[model samples]
Target: MIIPAIDLIGGKVVRLFQGDYAQKTEYSASPQDRFDLYVSEGARYLHLVDLDGARDPAARQLETIASLIKNTPVPVEIGGGIRSRKDVEDLLNIGADRVVIGSCAVKNPTEVKEWFRDYGASHIVLALDINIDPVSGKRFIAVKGWQENSGVTIEDLIADYREAGLRYVLCTDISKDGTLKGTNVALYTDLHREFPDISFIASGGIGSLDDVRNTAQSGAFGVVLGRALLEGKFTVKEALECWPNA
Candidate 1:
């Protein structure tokens, strides 16, 4: 599936470059307008991230999220600041098809395990944003909207959640995120080889139709297009056409 992203910052649609909050670029379009646009383009799924909620634990964008869900025909999966059972329940109650657990999952794996079992693997998705050491090339997880390093490796977290029955995992290379440089194909390909059972959603650094094709060829279950789609680099129709078998 080709998931169009609507990243929210202060109730406005925005995109951050390489996960740097200071380097954010806000679009003039409203969230509802973007939702309508994606729906019109034949998008089956939408990816919504709460930039505010990720940084503020007390943040709640339920009103905006609810409006998008009520207005759009396609299912939307939300992430950021979802830290508790209530957060998951509230999002689900408000019609979120799935909630991506990020910082909280990394902080407390045991509690997240219970959530996976309770909410069912399909309803709960894990967002693993990573930073690769420049020299050693070792990947480590980044949390709290990619503001802090968790010191946990992607491999370790995947191993921890493997038995939790997680069906979906969204992996984003923090360096490539919002850069439109291209996805880290080697990372995802290696992940697929190691955990072939889990459906991985490739996020970050998608610049054009060719990038989407490369991601699909690398065995990603789906791709999350943020800046590329918003910047008019490629139309959703074109992307979907490139991966007809996706």
Candidate 2:
């Protein structure tokens, strides 16, 4: 599936270069307009991130997100600054199909696992941002809006969650994110092969239709389109066409 993504900062649609807040670009389109546009263009699912909430949970834009969810007909998954059960509950209560847990999941795996049990695996999605060491070729998980390295390997984290019935995982390659270069096909390919039961959603560096094709062929269940879609590099319909049976 070609899942369209909208990153929000102060209720405005925006995108950050490599997850850096200082290097941000805000789009003129409102979140509602962008959502409607994606729906019109054949997007089946949507990903929303609250940049404000990501930096500070207390500043979460719940009212704005709730309004968007109330209007969206398709499944919408929301993330950013989701650190507590109340945060997850608030999103789900407001009609979010899935609540994506990132830094909290890394900081408190036990607590997150309980959430999967309480909410069911289908209702919870784990967002793991990865940083690869250029010299050692090791992948480490980054948390807190990609500001802190958790010092935990992706393999270990997923393995731990697999026991708790983990269903969906959104994995992003920080190096390629917002760069418009290409996706980390090899990473998703290896992950898909290793954890065939989990639905892995590949994110970051989706620049062209061919990137979508490669991701689909990599066995990823879905791909999140951000900058490429926002910049009109291609439409959601064109991206879906590149994936067989999407």
Candidate 3:
């Protein structure tokens, strides 16, 4: 499935190159307009990231996010600066289909695990942003809006959540993110092989329909469309066509 993404900073639709806030590119289109367009094009799910919230929990744009979530017809999964149980509950209460936990999942596994057990696996998504070592080629988790390295490998963290009833994992390769070069097919393929039961959503570096095709072929349950869609590199409908029976 093609899940359209909207990264917001100050309630404006934006994209950060390699997760760097300083290198952000704000789009002309409004978030509501983009959401309407994507839904009209048959998007099954929508992904939202509160960029301001990511930098600081106190600065979260709850009103804007709540408005978007309340109005969205399809399932919406939101992430960024989701640190506490109240954060998860508030999003869910506002009609968020799933709450994505990134840094907290890596930093506080025990608390997040309890959330999984309490809220059920289907409602929580682990946003495991990966930063690969240049020399060692080891994939480590990048947290705090990709600002801090948790020093925890993707394999190790997922293993910790395996018994916690982890269902959805949104993995983004930091090097490949926002580059429009291509996705890391080998990485996703390896992940699928390692954890066949988990539904891995492939993110980052989606430049064309072929990228979407390759990601789906890599066994990704879904692909998140961001800059590519906003820049008109490909439409949501065109992306969906790339997936078999999507």
Ranking by lDDT: 2, 3, 1
**145-214, model 3: which lDDT tens digit per residue?**
7878899999999988999989899999988999999999999999999999989999999999999999
**Candidate number of the best TM-score:** 2
Could you tell me how far off, in angstroms, the CA of residue 58 lies in candidate 1 after the best superposition? Answer: 2.1
Residue 92 displacement in candidate 2 (angstroms): 0.5
- Higher-scoring candidate on lDDT, 1 or 2: 2
Evaluated against the true structure, the overall lDDT of model 3 is 0.91
Candidate 1 RMSD to the real structure: 1.2
Q: How well does candidate 1 match the true structure in TM-score terms?
A: 0.96
Per-residue error at 162 for model 2, in Å? 0.7
Candidate 2 per-residue lDDT over residues 132-234, each given as its tens digit: 9899878899986788889998889999999999999999999999999999999999999999999999999999988999999999999999999999999
* TM-score, every prediction: 0.96, 0.98, 0.97
Query: Where does candidate 3 clash, by residue pair?
Result: none
Clashing pairs in 2: none
Worst 10 residues of 1 by lDDT: 51-60
Per-residue error for 217 in candidate 3, Å, reads 0.7
